[model samples]
Target chain A: MEIKAIGCEPLSLKRVGIQDGHTLKVYQDTGGYVQLKKAFGMSPDEIIQHVKDSALRGRGGAGFPTGMKWSFVPKDSPKPKYIVCNADESEPGSFKDRYLLEYDPHALIEGMIIAGWALKASTGYIYFRGEYNYLIHIMDRALAEARDAGLLGKNIFGSGFDMDIHTHTGAGAYICGEETALLSSLEGFRGHPRMKPPFPAVEGLYACPTVVNNVETLTSIPQILEMGGIAWRDLGTEKSGGTKLWSISGHVKKPGVYELPMGYADMEKFIMEDCGGMLRDNKLKAVIPGGSSVYIMNAGQILGKNVTLDYEGIVEAGSMLGTGGMMVMDETVDVVETTKNLSEFYKHESCGWCTPCREGTDWLVKIFNRISVGEGRPEDAQLLLDICDNIEGKSFCPLGDAAAWPVQSAIKQFPDDFKKWLTKKANGNGIEANI
Target chain B: MAAATPTSYTDKVIVSDEVAEFSPEIIAEMNEHLAKYPPERKRSALIPILMLIIQRERGWVDNAGVNFLAKFLDLEVTDIWETATFYSMFNLRPVGRHHIQICKTLSCKIMGEPEITEHICSKLGIHPGETTEDGKFTVSLVECLGSCGTAPMMQIGYDFHEDLTIETVDQILDSLR
Candidate 1:
C-alpha cells in the first residue's frame, strides 16, 4: 500500500515500481545487482570508507552510523567474521521492513552480500520473525534465482569472494530484534539480551566478529553505492542522508507507507496534507512519530513546534525517530487507555532477562489496568513515572527504555488525561487477560 | 503454556524417555537445516527443526516432540523449554486446527481492536487462549505482527487478516469452518 510516494528519488523501494520487480530477471534488467559489482570493484576498505562518507545511519532506530558499526568488526581476526541482517521488524508500529522484504527481497540480498564482501565474511543470515513465515518461500525463491544468476554462492562477479546467505526465523520474541539477543537466538538459546561491552560487533554469532544490519540499513547499501556516498548524503538533511520511508498509520485518511526524503516536511504539513489529514474529520490530538516505543507527542508538541521526521529533527522535538513508524491519533483516542494498551505489549514481549524490564513492564500494565478501570490514585501519574524512571536505562536492553518512554511522555504531556481516566470507568465488556 | 506453572516446572526436570518417531523425509529435512550451521553448532538449527516439529504435530510443541528434538540436536530438554516459553509463537499446549492470533498492541488497540477481539470471542463462544469444544478454532491475542500501517490485524494459520471489521471477522470464521 504505497499511498503517496513523495521523495526526490527512491533508494530501497525503486524496484517496487517495476512489473515482476521482485524477480531476479526484472531486478537485473533494471540494474538491481549492479551495485554489488561496483562494490566488488572497490577495495573492502574503500567500500567501508564510502559507506562512512555517505553518513548512512542505522534505519532500525538507534541512528548509529552504519559504516562505523562495520569498522568495529576486528579485521584479520583468527575467527571468521559474519554478517547478520535483522529482518525481525518487531517494534509495535514498525512495518516498513516487511514491505521491503516482501517487495524487493533482492535488495536485501545484495546489501547482505556487499556487507559480507566489505567485512570479508563468507556467511550471512537474514533473521525473519516467525510471523512473516509466508515470506520465507518468496525469499528462498529470490535466493535460488540469485544463485542461478551467479549473484550468490562462491565467486560473484568474478571477484573471487565467496558468500552465502541463509534465512532464519524467530518464534515471537520482540527482544530478538536487539542485535545481541538476535545473536543469542540465532545460536539456539532463549532470546535474552547480553551485556553490551561485548557488543555484537566484537563477539557476535559463535563469538566471532559480526555485523548485524537492519533491513532498511542493508537495503540502502545498493543505492548508496549506486549514487556515490557524498551525493547520496546530500539528498537529505545535512546529517541523515538519503530517503526514509514513513509508515503512517492510526486515525489518518491515507494510512500507508510513504517514501519521503529525510526532513522533507514538518509534522503538521505531512499529517494534514501528505497523509490526506485525519480520518472522520476529527482533530489530530497526538502523533507518535517513530513507532509506539518513542515518546507520545501531543498535537502542540508536534504541530505547534513544527517537528520533522528525521533522526535529529525528532530528537529536537524530544523523541527519537525510531523506525519511522508514525502512529497518528485523533481526538477520539483516549491517551490513558492507549498508553495502557502499549504497556500490555511491553509486558507480553519482555524476555525476562533483567529484573527492571521483566517486573517493570508487568507493574506498568497492572497500574494502567487499574487506571483504565477507575481505580487510579491521585499520585498514579507520579508512581507510573517512578516505575518508568527505574526502567528507562536500568534494564538489559532498550526494550525497557522503549516500554517506559511512552508512559513517561504521556503523563508529562497529557497530565490531565491520567487523572481524567482516574474518575472514568471503561465502557463495554472487556476481555480478561486470558492469553 | 508451561510458563504459567513455574513452581511445578522447576520441581520436575523429567523429560519423557519415549520420543516421537519422524519419517525419513522429515529427518532428511532436519538434516538439511542442520547442515546450515557448523557441525559443533548443531544447536543453531534448533529453531528451524522446532518449526518442522510444530508443523508435523499440527498444533503445538508437545513433550514427545521436545524430547525428539533434544535427542535430535543433542541438546538438553531444558534448552528446548527455554526457547519454547520465551517466544509467543510456539504453543506449549494443544491448539485447534485454525489458531487465530489477534494483535492487542497499541497500534491495533487504538484502531478498534477491543471491538474486534470482542466480536471474534462472542461469535466463537470462547475467550482468548481457549479452544472451542469442536476443536475447530483457538484464539490468541498476540502482540504486534508488524502490520500496524494497516492496523487492527490478526493471523489465522499463516495468513494475515488486517483492517478487520465485524462482517469480515464473521465471514472469516464462517469460511474457516
Candidate 2:
C-alpha cells in the first residue's frame, strides 16, 4: 500500500510515520525547525500579515480567518497571553486532529509557535481529549525534545523571544472543545464554557489575551510559512485556502483520512473514486456532510444537489463543512431514532452551567428518546423546535447551539419520521415494538 | 473540642490495591496541575485527579476509590463523588471489557444509527445498558461519541467505529474476541 502525502505531494512516510506519534524524527529530518528559524527572523507583525494575506481560515468548524483572529489579541494587554490548540476531537465523526497529533505533532508545535509569535504570547497549551492517552505521550516527548533543542524555551533558536508549550489532557468533555471552555479548563476551572464577545482574543486563559485555534488550523501554518500565502491560496477556493484533511468514515468502501484540495467537487465522486465507494451494495440513506454538529441531509437531497465537498458547496446545501467528518449512512435507517440518539449525547455532555443548555438538551433527549422508542406525542416535533430555540444563543457557550442545530434541522428536513413515531404510539405499539 | 488533625480522616478511607497503584501517577499529575495554579488553591486539581484515578481503574469511581482520593487530596468524599458523577466520563457501574458506546445523538440518529444500534443489541443478545453474559461487550445506548459525520457510530475503548453496520460491528466484535 502506498502512503498518502499532505497536499497531494509525494510524502516520505518516514518523515510522518503512520505509527501512533512520529512528530519528533519527522521534525528532525524534514528540517522542521528551519521554519522556526525563518520565523524568528521576521517581526511578529510581519508573521501575522503573512497569514492574513494567505487567507488561511480556522479548520475548527467556524472557518474564521486565522490572521484576523491573531490580530484580535491586544498588543499592550497586561494579562499573560496564551495560545491554545483545540485538540479535543469530540465532534461526532471528526478524527482529523487525531491523525495530525499522532502523525505530525511538530506541525502543530510549529503552528503554535507561529500563532504565539503573531499574538505575542509566550505560553501555548494544547488541550487534547482524554481518550487520546497515547497521543499525549507522543506530544509530551516531542515537547521535551523541542525544549532540549533550544527551540521552545528561552531564546529559541538564539532569538530574543521566549516561548513554551504545554500539553494538557481533557477528561472526555466535548464542550471543552469550545475556545472559552477550553480556556476555563486550562485555568484549573470547571470545563464549562464562558460567554463570548470578550472573546478569547481579548480575554482568555486566566482572563488574559489569548488565541485558541484547532489542531488542523495550527498544523496548516508551517506550510503557509514555507510555501508563502499566495502559493497556499492557489490550491483551494477564493475564500478557503490550502488543502484540507478529510476524515471520511461510515458506509464508504474505504473509510480513512484523505488529503484533498479544498474545493474538491462531487461528494459522491470523492467517496466513490478517491476513497472507494459505499461499503457493499447498500443504498445511501443519509449523509452528515460535516461533523455531527451540522444538519443531516437525506441521500436524495445530497445527490440532487450534486453536492461538492467544500465550504461554499456545503453551505449552499444548508449545511456547514464542519471539520470534514463526512459520515454516510445506508438505507434501512430510521431517522427519528437517529435524532433521538444525538439528542441524548448533547444532554449527557451538557455541563449544566447554563439552564437553557442543560435543561433544553435534557428535554430534547427526552423527547427524541420517546419518539425513537415509539412513544412520541403529536406535539413532540414543536417541542423539539421550542427546546432548540430556547437553547440557542441563550446558553453561555456555543455548544448549546451546536447541540440544538442538528435536531432542529433534522425535524425541518424529515417531519414524517417524527409523525410516524407519533402514529406508532397511538396504534398501541410498545416503544421498542416499532423497530 | 480540639481541632482534628488532617491525617485522622485518612484512617477511615479504604485504599484498594488498584487505587494504591494509581496514587503515585495521580499525585504526580495532580501536582503538575497544581503548579499551574496558586499553591494554596491546590484543590483545583481535585476533579482532574479523580478523573485520572477513574480512568486508570477503567470506569467508575468506586466508594473506596473516592474515599481514597478524598484522603489523598484532603477533600471530602462526597465532594469527589459529586464531581465524578457530574461528568458522563465516569461510568458509575461496571462496564463490559469492550464497552460499546453507540451514538444516539440527533445527527447520528438521523443518519440511521438507531437501526445500527438495534442490530448491535440483537447480535450481542443484550439490550442497551446490558452487558453480554460472557462479558465480551456491554452495549450502552450513549449520547454522541462525537463522530457525527459518520453517523451510526460507536466507540470501543479509544477507537471510534463509524459508518456502522451489523456486519462491521460483528467483525469488530470478532476481532476483539
Candidate 3:
C-alpha cells in the first residue's frame, strides 16, 4: 500500500500515508473534506475560474483542460446537470485509477462534491469499471461514511447546495471509458460511443448538460483548490500543470505507480533509477511510452532521446502520454507478437458501431496473428499500414484509431521483426519452424 | 425457482423456463440498491441486480434471471441481454465452480502469459474456453484485469493472483482442489 511521489510534493497520494487511509475518520484527520468547505464558501464561478487558472488537464488519456471542459456546460441549462466520474480504467496497462479508488475513495468523493458545485450538478455518478469489482465495496463504504457524517447528501457544509453521488458499475467494456459510451452504459444499455459535436458537456447523461471527469482528474480537484491555482500551475510544465502518476509495468525490475511532476527529466533515467531498470538485467527493446494504444518507441529512438514524462513530451516522441501507462519491453520480447496481442484486445473491446472499427480491428488482429505465427506474406506489412490508414479517422470513435496506432507504430519502428516473420515458416503449430 | 411459461412475444424471444424470484430478504437488499439512484433512473441498478441474479443462480446469468431482471428493473429482455453480453465478467451459461480467468492481453502476454495459459490448460485437461469434465474448474482467457504492474495474473472468481509462476499456478490449483 506504499505510494511513492518522487521529486514533487504529493497531493493525491498524501492521505494514503495515514492508517486506514480509505476510512472517513482517517481521511478527515488529515484535513480531508476541508477543500469542499473552502469550495462551498466560494462562488461556483470563482471555483471554475480558479480551476481554469490552474490549467489542470484531464488525466484520463485525453489531456483536455479540465476547467475548459467544465466551462462548456451551459450555466443556464434548465435540464438537470450531472457530474460523471469515469473510473473505467480499462486501458490495457493502466491501473492507477483503481489504486486511488481502492486506497483513497474519499478523495474522489470530496473532489466530486466540488466538481458538482462548480458545474451546478445536482447528481453525480462514479462509472466504475466491472473488472475492479472489489473497489465498488470500498467506494460504497466510503460514500456511506460521507453521508452519515454530513459530507454528502442535501445541504452539504450548510451551503444550501444539494449534491448526491452514486456509484455505477460498468460490466466489462473498454469502449465505455469513452465518455458518451460510459453515459450509454450508465443508462443501462450497450456501452457504445456516440458521435461528438453535441459533446458530453453540451448534452450528456440523460441528454442534460453534463460534465464528465476522470477519477484522477476529479481527485486532483481538492488539492488544486487547497494549493491555489497559480502555485499548482508552477508545479508541472507550462502547458501541463501538476504532478502526473506513471503506471510503469512490463519488464521492469520494480514495477509500480510513481507520481512525478510533469516534464520530469529523462524517460530512460526515470525507468532505470525509479523503476530499478529492466527485469532480469535484460536489454531494453522498446517502450510503449503510455498505455497499449499509444505508439511504440523503439530502443534506438529512446536510448539517447531527451524524452520527458508529459503530454507534449510523449507526443514529440511520436506517442501520446495515454493514461501514463508505460509498458517496458526487454530484448527477448517480440514486437510483432506484442502488437498482435494488443490488436486482439482492441478487436475484442470494439463496440461494433462502425464497419472500419468493427471489421478493421479484427483484420488487424488477423494480420498480426499471421505475422506472429510465421505465416506473414511479404506484402502483409504494407497491408497492415493500409488498413490502419483507413481505420485511423474513417471510423466512428477513437477506438478505431487506437486499434491502428500500435500496429502502425510497431511496423514503422521495428520492420525487421515483421520481415523475419515473413521469411520464416510455421509448421502446423503456431511456433516458428526453421527459424 | 418456479418454471416460467413463456408468453411468446416471438418464437425467437424465448426466455428461460425456470423464472427466478428473489426472496423477501433479497428483495429488500435490491430495494436498498435502488434507493441509491433517483426513482426514474431505477434502470441504473441493472448491473447490481444482474450481479445478484448471477450469484443466486449459481454462477451464470440464465434467461430466467434476465427475465426476472426485466420485470424487476422495468427494462426489456433485449436490454438485459445487451448489457450482460457486453460485459466480460458475466457468464451467460453455467460456469464451473471455480472459473480461472487468465489475462491474455498485451501487458500480461509480454510477461510470459502464453506459457502460463498452456500450463494451466494442460494441467486442468481443459482448453481456454472449456470447463473441466468434473465441472470443478473452467479456464477462460480474459482481457487485462488492470493488474498489469503485477503481470502474468489470473482471477479465480473475484480474487486476483498475480506475478504467477508455473509452480505458483500449480499451488493455486492444488489448493483449490
Candidate 4:
C-alpha cells in the first residue's frame, strides 16, 4: 500500500493522553489560556478576520466555514447573542469530540473564549450529548476553576470582557447535532430541526443571534490564534485548513482516534500503517470514508486510487469528509447487514419532522431487514434507490439525506450483495454472504 | 424537516394527576439545577430536574413524576412529557436497578455485537428491552453511545464497557451481581 509522507503532529488532541489533563491547573501550565489573553488585545472583528484567513471549517458533518459562520451572526442585533458548542457528536462511527471533552476540558473553554470574542457573544453553552454524562462533572469543575481564577466571569483578564460558559445535556437524539435541532433541545423543547431561512445567525437559541460550532472546530481556534492564520492555513490544503481529528473504527487492528493533517493520510496507509493494518489480516471489502451518512466506497476505489482524507479528496471519490469518521469493513463482513444496522439507526433517530425522512427511513430499514432474512424481492433494489431519490432533497433537514446516502451507496457499490440476498439462506437474523 | 407542529407528532405517554413528593435533600438538588437557568426560563431546568426525579423516585420517569415536575417547573403536563419521551435515555417506565444499554449501531454490529447481546440476554434470562424478573437488571438494545472505536460495547449507568467478549460479559455481569 502506498503511503503519504506527511508525519503525525498532535494539535487538538495535544493534551488528551496526559495525566490529570482535564484539570485547569494542568491545562494552564501547558499554555491553555494564553489565546484568551492574546484575544484581549485584538478586536472581535480582527479575531474573526484572522480565523477567516485561517480557513478553518466546521469539523461537524456540514464542513461550513467556521469564520464565515461567526461572521453571519448579526453585529447589530439588540437581543443577547449566544455561542453554542455542538458537542453532540452522535454520528455513527464517530467519537472524536468525547475525547477532547474527557481529557482536555479546558482547551474547549479557552477556545470558546476566543470564539465568543469573535462572535461578540456574552454567554456560551456546550450542548453535550446525553450519553456523555461522565464528562459533565469534568466540565463543571473546569468551569468553576476558571471562574475562581477570574478568567471566565466579568472582567476576564481585566479586559472588561464578561462571558460565562454553561453545559447543556442532550437527552439522546442524533438529530440534535444539527444546529437548529440542538437549539430546540437546549430550550427544553422536542429535538426537531426548524426551517432554516432565518438561520441560527438571525434567530436562534431563544430567538437571539447564535453561532453554533462543532467541538473540534471551536477547539482549533486557540491554536489558530497562537500560530498566525496564514501559518495555520498552510498546515492544511487551500480549501480545507488545519489538522483534523479522524475517528477510525471497524475491522482495524488498532481502531482509535488519530489527528492527521488534512489531505495528508492516504486511504491505504491510514488503514494499513496508522491503524496497524486491518483486523485478523482480512482483505478490505469496502470503506465508508466519512461517517455512515456519507457514501460508501468499494475496495477498488479506495485501495490504490489516490483517495485522500480531506473534504476535496473524499468528495472527489464521491463521498464527503463528514466529521472525519472513517468506518472500514473487511471481506468477512456482509455489506447488506451493515447497511441494515445503519438503516435501523436512522429510522430510530428520525425526528419525524418531515414525511419523507420519517417514512423513507422506516422503508429503508424494512427493505434491508427483509433482504437480511432471505425474504427480499429482486425488484426491491430499484425500489430502494427510488425511495432514496425522494428522500434526499425532499426532506426538511439533512437527516433524511443522511439516511438515504448509505443505503443508496451500499447498493450502488455492492449491488450483487443486495441481489444475492434474495435466494440466500438466513440463520435467524442475518444471511451468510460472500460479496 | 418541515415546520410540523407539536400536535401533528404527539407521542402517547401515560399521564397521571398524582403528584409525587420528594425529600428535602432531593428538592434542594432540583433547586440547584434550577439555579443554572434564569428565573424566567425555569423550563430550561426541566431535563435536569426530571433526571433527579428519576434518580429519587424509582429508576424512570413515571406519570407521578411528570405531574410533579409540571407543578415544580410551572409548565404544562404535555410539555414535560414531550421532552421526557423524546430522549431515549429518559426511561418513561420503571427500570431495573441496573440498566444495560447495548449499542446496536453499525460499528458495534460489525464487531460481534450480536453475540455479545445474545450472551448478555441469555445469561440474564430476558430479551432486549425486557427487565429481569428479579428487577436486578434491564437489558436494552440502544443506538450508538459514541464509543465506536471500541465497538461491541454497552453502557450500564454512566460507565462504558468496551471491546466486549462473551467472557467479559459474563465477568462484568457476575461482578455486578
Candidate 5:
C-alpha cells in the first residue's frame, strides 16, 4: 500500500547532529540561530506581532495561542521579566520535547532568545523534568556553545539585544509543568501550583511579568520569524498555525515522532496509513487522543467520527489535542486495567499540595485497582465519577483535572467493561484475577 | 548460588568524606540545583535533593537520610518524607542496585504489562516490593516512566528500556549484571 505524506517536511533543524552532542557546528550548519539574528534586528513588539501573525498555539496541551500568551505579559511591568520554556514534558505519551532537547538543543536556545526578545526579558529558563538527565547534559553543552559563539548573553549577535538562557531541572513533579507551579519551582519553592487571575502573565517568576511557552511552541518561533508569519500561518488550520511534532506510539508499526501540519492530518489515516496500522494482526481497540490525561475514545467512536489531528477536532470530540500524543491500544487490551494503570500514575505523581488532588487521586487509584482485579462494586463507577468531579475544579492546578479526566472518561465510554468487573466480583473471583 | 555479603561503609571506598559525613554526592548535587533558584526559596530544591539521595543510595529514603536531608534544608522530617513519597521517583525503602521500575501506566498495561511484570518477578524470584538475595536486582512497580508508546517497558537507573518482552527483559537484566 502507498502512503501519502501530510504536514510539513521533517525539517532536520533540531536533529542535525543529534548523535554528536559535543559541537554546535552542525546546528550552525543547519542555519541554527539565524532566526535569532533576524529577530535581534526587530523590536520586541515586532517580534511579538510576528508570532501573533503566525497563529502559533501552545504545544503543551493547553493549545493557548502562543502570541496571545506573550501579549498577556504586562508591558508596563517593572524590570526583571522572564520567558520560560516549559521543557517539562511530563505528560504521559509525550516525548517530543525530549527529542527536541536532545537533538536540537540550540533550536530551543534560539527560540528562547526570540521569546526573550519579544517579552523584552533579559533572562530565560528551560524548566526540564528530572528524568531527562541525558537531555539536560545535551542542553548544557548547547548552552555553552551558544555562549562561546556570542549567540547568547549580553549584546547577542551585535544587535544590542542582550538575553541569557538558563536551564532548571524539575524534580519529578508533573504539576510543575503548570506555569505557576513551574515558577514556584524556579523560585526554589515546593512546586505547589499557585492560583490564576494573577496568572503567570501578570505576576510570574519572581513576581514579575512572564511568558511561559512549551518547548515546541518556542522552537517554531525561529522558523516563523525566518519564514515570515503569513507564510508560516498558511501551514495548519486558522487557529493553530505552523507545524507540530506528533508523538505517535503504542501498537503502531511506526511508533515515533512525525512532523505534520495541524488539521491537515486525520487520526485514523495517520494511525492506519502513516503508522502502518496496529502491530501485526492486532485490531485497534481504543485511543487516548491526546496524552493519558485526556478522555479515552472507543475504536468504534473514533471510526464513526471523522476527526482531524488538530486542536479544533479534538475539542469537538470532548478532548484536547494535548501535546499531540496519540497513544493507541489494541483489541487484546483490557479497559479496566488501562484505567487502573492511569489512576495509579495520577495517584503517584500527585504533589499533595491540593487536598482534592492528593487524596482523590489515591482513592481513585485504589478503587480502579480493585475494579481491575475483579473486586469491583456496582456503585464503584459512579463513585469514581464522584471522586473525579471533586478533583476536577477543586485542586490548585490542572494536575487534579489531568488525573481525574481519564478515569472518569474511561468509565463513561467503557461502562460495559467496568460492569464486567463487578459481575466477576459477584462470582467471587480473586482480586488479582485476569480479565 | 552463594549469597553476597552486604558491603560495609568502610569496606567500600567512600568517594568523598563529605559524602560520608553528609550522605554522598546527593547533597552537593542538590546544592548545585538549589543555586539555580534564589536563596530565599531554597525549599524548592527539596524534592530533587531527596530524589538524588534515594537514587545514589538505591531505593527509598530511610529515616536517617530523610532526617539528615530535613535538617540540611531546615525542613521537618515529615515534610521531607511527604515530598519523597509524593513522587514515584523517591523510594521509601531499600532496593537492589539496579532498581527495575516497570512502567505499569495505561498504555503499558494495554500492551500486556501483566505478563511482562510477572515475568520479571518470576525471573528475579521476588515480588514487586522484594529484592533478590544476591542484591543485584530489585523489582518495583512504578506508576509511569512517561514512555507509554513503548508500553510494557521498564526503567533501570536513568535509562528507559522500552518495547519489552520476556527475552528483552532477560537481556536487559543480564546486561546490567
Candidate 6:
C-alpha cells in the first residue's frame, strides 16, 4: 500500500487506511451496510438501471457490463436463484482479487447482499481458489461477524430479504475462473467449463439462474449504489467507469498493487514514474500490458504511444485491458523463455476437458523445450504460431485463448527472439527440424 | 497448516483399498457442508469436505479417502477420482511434510525462480520432484499462485513465503523443522 503520490485515491482499497479494515466494526463505522437500506428500498429494476448508468464492467478479466449481466437472470425462473462471487485469483500476473478478499471482505459481502436484493437471490457463494486456502479464515470470520450482527441470513436489515453467503474452495484448477467452470467446481464436480448460450445467468449453481462476478466487480456494487451510477461512471473515462485495481509486477522498481481511476494516465508514465521505472534502471524491453493472458507489447508499442490504461485505450495500444495485471520486463529478461514459462503454466493448469487446451499446451511446451535446448528448427516459429492459431478459439473456454495469446503475440512482436533459440548448426544448414 | 496445498510426490499411480475413518466431530463438520447444498445433491459437498477433511485427517488424497467420500456422498468411485485427479492441489499420492511449491510461471521466472529452485534442491540434496533423505522436504515447481507482485514465492504447506532469496530460503527451511 506504500507508494509515492499517484494522483488518484483508490476507491476499492479505500478501507486500507483502517488498522483493522478486515473487521466488521471498522467496515460498519465507515458507512458500510447502509447501502443495503437504500438498495432494498428501490425496485430491482431501479437498482439495475443505476448500475447500467454506471457503465460498470466485470473486473474478472472480461469487461462485460455488470448491469447487463445481472438483468439476464430470468426473473420468472421456477428454481431458486443465487448470486456467486468469482474470487478465484489464479491468473498469472493478477492478484487484485486477493487484495480485496483479504483487506476488504465486508465490501464484497455487502456487494453480494445488494446483488441478492437485486436478483432476489436467497443464497450466495464466494469461490476462492485453492491456492488461497490459507486466507479462507479471514473471509469466514468476516461472514461470521456479519451473521452475528444479523447483517446476513434470515431477514437481513429487517426487510424480509433473506440472503446468505458461503465460501467454496477450488483445489487448483485455473479453468474454474471461467464462470461455467467455476459453477461446475462449486457443484462439487471437476472444474471443467460448460457450453455457452445457457450461460451462468440463465442456469448456474445447482442448475439455477446464477450471476458470477469477480471479487472486484462485486465489491464495486456498494460504491456504485452510494455515489449513484452516473457519478461513478464519470469518475473514470467515458467507456470505463470507476476506478480499477491493477496488479503491476516484474522488473519494476516498485512492484505492487495500485489503484487509480481508469485511464488516469498513460501506461508509459505509470510505468516510468508511478512504478519507479525499470528495475535497477535497466533498459525496458517487453511488457505484458494485462494479465499474462493478453497480447504482449514491446517497448515501441508502449514507451511513447500515449497508451492510456483503460479498456478502450489498451485496445488502442493493441492489447486488451485484461484484469489490469501489467507485467514489465527489462532488457535482462528473455522474451522466449518468459512466454515459455507461461505456456508451462497453461499446460500444468489446463483441466484436460478438451483436446486443444490439454494437448496443445503440452505440444507448445515440447516445442519450447526443443527450442530452449538448441534443437529448434527454422519452421518452429511458424509452427508455434500455427499451433496457437489452432488453439485460440477451439477449446471449451477461454483458457486455450489465454494459453495461446501471449505466445502468439510474443512471436508476432519478437520474431527474432524465438528464432534466436535455433541452434547455429540448424540455422546454417536450413534444417527442417522434426519434433 | 499448508499441509493441504499443491504438490505431488511421485509419478507412480497408487491406490489404497482401506477406507479412511473419521471422528464423529469430522462427520458433523462435513454434515454442515452438505447442508449448504440441496438434499439430493450430496456430491456438491465433496470438494469442500474433501478439502477440510483431507487436509487434517490425511496428508494426501489416497484411494481410501476417496472411497470414504464416495460412500459418504453416494457417488461412484469414478465420480470421485474424476474430480479429485482434475485439480493439482489434491495430491493423489503421499508427499513430504513440507510441500515447497515454488512458482515457476512468467513473473516469478523472470524474477529469479531458477536460482531459488537450484538453491533449495541442492540444499535438500534432492531434485524438483524428489523428497529429502529424511522426508522432511519436497520441492516442486508449481505454476503461479496469484502472488505476482512478490515474485519467486513458494507456498510451503499453506503459508506463502514470498520475495524468496537463497539466504531467506535457508532461514525459512532452517526454521521449518
- Model 6 spans > 4 angstroms off: A1-5, A423-435, B1-16
- Kindly give the stretch of ten consecutive residues in candidate 2 chain B with the minimal lDDT sum: B4-13
Whole-model lDDT per candidate: 0.85, 0.73, 0.85, 0.85, 0.76, 0.86
Number of the top candidate by DockQ? 1
Pairs of residues clashing in candidate 1: none
User: Backbone clashes per model, in order?
Assistant: 0, 23, 0, 2, 5, 2
Would you give me the overall lDDT of model 6? 0.86
lDDT of 5 by residue, A221-337 (tens): 888888888788888778878778777777888787777787854777888888888888588988887888888888876775778878888878777788888788888777877
Candidate ranking under TM-score, highest first, comes to: 6, 1, 3, 4, 5, 2
- Model 2 scores what on Cα lDDT? 0.73
Each prediction's DockQ against the real complex: 0.76, 0.28, 0.68, 0.52, 0.36, 0.73
The list of candidate 5 runs beyond 4 A from truth reads A1-5, A12-22, A424-435, B1-35, B38-85
Of the two candidates 3 and 6, the one with more favorable lDDT, higher being better, is: 6
In what order do the candidates fall by DockQ, top score first?
A: 1, 6, 3, 4, 5, 2
Q: For each of the candidates, what fraction of the native contacts does it recover?
A: 0.89, 0.33, 0.81, 0.81, 0.48, 0.89
Show the colliding residue pairs in model 6: B2-B157, B2-B158
Cα RMSD, each candidate: 4.4, 5.9, 3.5, 5.2, 5.3, 3.6
As a whole number from 0 to 100, the lDDT of residue A153 in candidate 2 is 80
What would the per-residue lDDT of candidate 1 be over residues B31-139, giving only the tens digit for each residue? 9788878899999998878875544454567777788889999989888888777777777667899999999887788888999999999999999989899989999
Cα lDDT for residue B83, candidate 5: 56
Candidate 1 lDDT over residue span A185-241, tens digit each: 999999988888888888999999999989999998988898888888888877888
Which is superior by TM-score, 4 or 5? 4
Q: Compare candidates 3 and 4 on DockQ and give the better one.
A: 3
Off by over 4 Å in 4: A1-6, A423-435, B1-15, B52-56
Evaluated on CA atoms against the true complex, candidate 5 attains a DockQ of: 0.36
Candidate 1 docks at the CAPRI level of medium
Candidate whose lDDT is highest: 6
**lDDT per residue, candidate 2, B63-92, as tens digits?**
666766777766776666655655565666
Write the number of the candidate with greater lDDT, choosing between 1 and 6: 6
